[model samples]
Target: MARAVVRAVSASPTAQAGGQVEEDPAHRTAAGLLASHPWHTTPLGVPGGWDPALRATIELIMGSPVAMSLAYGDAYTLIYNDAFATILGGKHPAAFGRPAADVFEEAWATPGVGDVVDRVYRTGEPFREAETAVALVRSPAGEPEQAVFTRGCSVVRDSQGRTIGVLTVATETTEATSRLQSLGELTGALAGAVTLDDVARVALRYGLSAFDVDHMTFGVDDASGWRVVRRVRGELLDEADERLPPLWRRLPLDSPSPLAKAAGSGTAAFTEDGTPLREVAADRHDQRQRAMAAIPLSTHSLRGALTFGRRHAHLWLPAERAQLTAAADLIGQAAERARRFETQHGTAQLLQRSMLPEHLPNLDRFRVAARYDPGIDGSAAGGDFYDAFVLPEGRLAIVLGDVAGHDMHAAALMGQVRAALRALALANPDPVVVLDGLDKLVGMLGTGTRSHELFVTVAYGLLDQRDGGLTIASAGHPAPLIRHASAEGQLATVGYLDVPTGTPLGLGGAHRAMTTALSPGDTILLFSDGVIERRRRELDDGLAALAKSVAEAVSGDPRNLCALATSAVAGATEDDVAVLAVEYASTPSRSATMNVPPEPTMPGRVRQWMKVQLSAWDVPEAVIGAAVLCTSELTTNALLHAGTAARVHIDLTPERLLVSVQDSGTRGTVTRAHTDTLSSRGRGLGLIEELSDAWGTDPTVRGSTVWFEILLSEDRENP
Candidate 1:
């Protein structure tokens, strides 16, 4: 009980004119306690001689329902009501008539409380604290516990406005404030998680710190019910113990365990007896976990649960269970989003791979490598592709192109264009002719379709194995970069090809081919615009950076060079990327030219000249046999069809041997007709095709030159 002292004062006749003030029951209760207290004989003197301001303030505090107190006089005597006495705990009656510091010695000694009280008394100004924490002994024999309070202090004044005491009012908010702060920290930590594993790791780390638990396990629902994905032990575990049993690594959702029940009901559950779950948790760990809790986690596409364990038997409070449930919900939502994205990304990759080539063709004269990467947005497939294949006459055709969209439609169109180009290229050896045919094909395919405006940019090249040069043509595509070796053996980009940029396919236009020579040890690089058309970067800057990277990796392997180039720009652009690098291997050059008369003996003369040249070059007998047969077939076709003399040229290199037979008449196009089984005259081109690795025709100043190449056997030693 708390007490207050009442002073008896004799009133003058004028003062007695006003009716006597009514005594409040709360003030009377305190007065009775203070009258019997020992401190009644102290310097404060039973409150009879107290100042008018102190007496008035005490009366106001006793009458109010608010918890308040008043400290008066030089010694600051204590005076408070029943409401405030509850805060005093067991010290209420003993605290009566004593100085404020003596009654609340422990609390007054706290940093902010005492200072605030003194400042309000001295400055005659109000002081307030939104939240103040103090350690105080609520009972005489009890240990001190920390309590948080929102306190306000103001000066008490008499009728003349002279300060005489300090009045204080306070409210305790320890539990509410602490819970809010802990929940805030947990939410902030979970916001940064972007993957399922990230969510598990972050939740485990913060949940353990925020809750009272010895260990925690996080489980997610999968094909095998619920499985623990992460396990974390609290500080109670011994640091030296490395052997711990795998506890609760897997749990069946339909089981009678607390975690399962919680997940099934979508609610929080707890158990004091760990025996029910001990079998599942029986790992190498020796800690006697006697108590546990389960919090259900669920979202639109995800279902999971979290379990917490304690070494001693304990009951969870309602507040603790609520916080755990909220945290579990956050983790479930984040993980669900991550899993959805992963599935979409995997599907897009599968679709993109199906559209691109599995591997570039293996060439003996050139080292070829190519790479394709999808756009930054991983959900949709982009339209970038690269192809390398053997053409007639030992030429290698490298194609890199991009359709004008970033969806499945674009990928489908890319596949159609690629297949059509390959089929057309086998019949015609000229890049210009190939592009012209491709343009018409694309136009026909796009007409009257939703993708009528969809166009494709392409950079196609035919590599001449005999001279180690490239004949390139562009269809509104970025020019190919040619790297030339300097005298010091260092490589640099000579320049982009100067080919005329024709209109993109799907529209009608004339396409021309430009010739660029590549020496041994030189490389030709072709790429989609995604490599040099990044956001916020100028086209020239990107091209310059690409050139620099290529020059630096000049001595690197062709496969590694392609990887480096694609990686540099893969993430910087939103378009799909395709890069192809072709390096010419150095080979000894040899050539023999012979003129064949326009006679019935032309085929025999051509074969004799090929045999002589091949024998002098020390070629293998297998290759000599194939080369002679292919030469005879080509010579007979040229002299019989063109009605002119044939100019025969045989060029041999370390990789392949080229046979060129030119005629005085011009035949720009040669089609491979399907010959019947009994037709002998039409089998000339068929036999040439069957015997040679590749064959093609190129129009020259005099006439047309048709050629074929036979790939030499690897077992034959190079000269």
Candidate 2:
């Protein structure tokens, strides 16, 4: 039998042969290998001749408390150790000389063991898990229970510095694991709680009961009134607790309260000698003076206070203050979220009413209906509006328009334009006439009044039911819809050709056109641009929708038709919208035909119409000369080329005069040409091209209409 002896980890030891040895970091590497790698019988790697003394020392190392083994190739053989036989479950000691994989195959299957071993093999880094679970073999009829382990690792090396195996040492950690579980449960109970009141109760019950505290309370500060959220009292609290006032009501947001200052600065104010209570007494009204600490409960802008007090004037402990300070931060986070929620709710209400009308008008023919629907997803208001009133001629002048933006500024501009349009229209009954007048007045309305170009698009109409007709005009506005009483009534677009109507109000245009037609029924549809402007679709799609809705609702009264149009547009998208629908009692038929008489030469008729248009446009005498010359030349072009029936329609507005010729011919493009030697016949077309500011052709089902415009002095003054 080979005798075994144990030596201490230092250079010398005093262990008898065949007994246990104390394990420590210095020799843990060699001890772990001999215990697990049980079957090796190679010569010791020490140099032979000079280390006989060391070889004898290595032999004596075998008598340690740990199991002893050696491995050669794949075979593990137990060398000699009393501890080696104890770990074999019920197997006899004869089982010692076997493969290491076969002996501990079940142990290798334990969770987390394989991963640790693989890290040591691949990266050569010793990995340790603290308080990890492990399984150990027992006697017969036994079940495995979890056991905690602290593990260490080291790489085993042969003489050439090549890794041969890995060594591991593990110790039980069951007692430490149980204490950690209890601590986690207590912390979780405090973190998951809500409400300052509940938080105070939890703090008092757990913090005071465990730490033996006298009092605990939570403090909060915000825009609303500030107050002490809670004050704890118990059986001994009456005697132990300092007689403290309701601190919450006394400390307001504006006051210099200790909790408010600590919360605002996000700094913990702690003093064992009652410095916090003394500061509060000096700055505010506090009767009691005892040991107090303000644990700052602050996150972002929300502040929370955890104030402590003792019935006897004893100083607070540092450890206790530190614990409360951490809890204060958690409380502050919850308070911040609640404060933000309350602020957002208030902001929503304020923005909702910002765009609504300050007051409604009271006019005889104006039965105005207005509706404002703010966006559900945080948008306040967009620009849409309607206005109406009885003009001097008893005709109700109705205007509907949209400013181009969708903010408070857009809505404010919308209101200003709407009120201006009504005032101008009331002073002048012509829709075209009123708009031209407004164009001149825009410059006088201040720079802030006109913040953007192309600020608005409007459709204005003057309804003179006393005369049984409506004069309609537009400035880049959607067309007014007309529905009749017939069963198969198709929605008709009533006005004639519309030009880019004076460049959308704000861009400095000289004129707007006023076209008139007899109202065919009791209903007329007037709407803002939103009725025919939709996203993800062409402009034609909105036009088609308006026509379809009007045709569907034709048989219904004006109120229903208006409702149908609004519903149709509103259902399609989220956008600002305004509409005005006026209905009058049905009237009997008027005289159908106008009496015709023989007239003079076409030049005379054209000249007379030009003067009438200039008067309506309110053009000064200075610009009338150019307008007269342009109108004459256009009429001559129509009479000469098409041999067509010609109708001259001249519209006079306050800003400019427009003269158009409707001819029975196809649209012909005009060319800029050199003037010929003053011949009367051909010079007319050249002169018209030169004198007119701008002109174009509108091709319709009947034929083509060539039109020209002259900028009047009125536009120059106002625009």
Highest lDDT against the true fold, candidate? 1
The regions of model 2 sitting more than 4 angstroms off are 1-378, 440-454, 487-500, 518-520, 554-556, 569-574, 587-719
The most accurate candidate by TM-score is 1
Model 2 CA lDDT for position 463: 67
The residue-by-residue lDDT of candidate 2 on 1-719, one tens digit each, is 11112123111221112234454543234433333221222333212221222222223224333332332222322233344444444443434434444555556566676555555645656454556766645444466645556545433333223344444433354333322222222232333232333344445555455445565556666455344533444533331122111112335565465666665566766545544455444322233535666677655565666666554566555645544554454345434433443355335434433434433333332223333332322234466766666666567676777777666666666666776777776666666676776665554453545444536677777766565467677776776765544423344333222433554666456555555444444356777656667667787777677767766552323334455566565334446666666644343211111111112246556677666655555567656677667666655555433334567765443323556676664212111121111113334545665776555554333345566665455444454
lDDT of 1 at 342: 51
Q: Model 2 scores what on Cα lDDT?
A: 0.48
lDDT (C-alpha) at residue 378 in model 2? 27
